[model samples]
Target: MLTRAQVDENDTVLITGASGGAESAAIQLAKARGARVLAVAGESKHESELDAGAQEVPIRGCPLQDQLGDNGVDVVIDLAGGPNWPELLNV
Candidate 1:
């Protein structure tokens, strides 16, 4: 999907649950392809995601909607999908 979407150095990618298998791979691949990778994962998994080449968007004590402002991310790779599904649709 990343390739189909033409994700490149100019893109900002948001990968949720990035510590998991699929998301983790997506993060690494997207980064390798030159996109700016922003990841959302458990507080404990932040370091791992960083190691995989993504910037963490702390989701623990912080409000997610606030962290993600009006201008949304260019691409979203969601592995742990939930209510955030609808939110992503809106974005």
Candidate 2:
């Protein structure tokens, strides 16, 4: 969708719920592909959620919303899929 949406390489991407499951998979995949991915969540410290030397782990918590104005993410992948979903949009 990013390619079709015309998102560029410098664009920041916000991915919610980074602590587990499929969302974690997507985080790793997106980072591997070279996107600057921000893993948004209340907390993230699971076993595989972050590898030993992952370049940048997503910035966690609602406080990160402050970045909305300037850090401005280009795309958002809300994997939490519910109430947490709105944080990505409303932020």
Index of the highest-lDDT prediction: 1
Question: Candidate 2, residues 1-91: lDDT per residue as tens digits?
Answer: 5555455556666676777677777676666566776666444463345552233444565455665556667777777777656566664
Q: What local distance difference test score does each model get?
A: 0.78, 0.61
Which 10 successive residues of model 2 have the least lDDT summed? 46-55
Best by TM-score: 1
Residue-level lDDT of model 1, residues 1-91, one tens digit each, is: 8988899999888887777788888998998889988888777887888888886555643555677776577888777777677665554
> For model 1, what is the C-alpha lDDT against the true structure?
0.78
**Which residues of candidate 2, in runs, are more than 4 Å off?**
1-8, 44-61, 67-69, 84-86
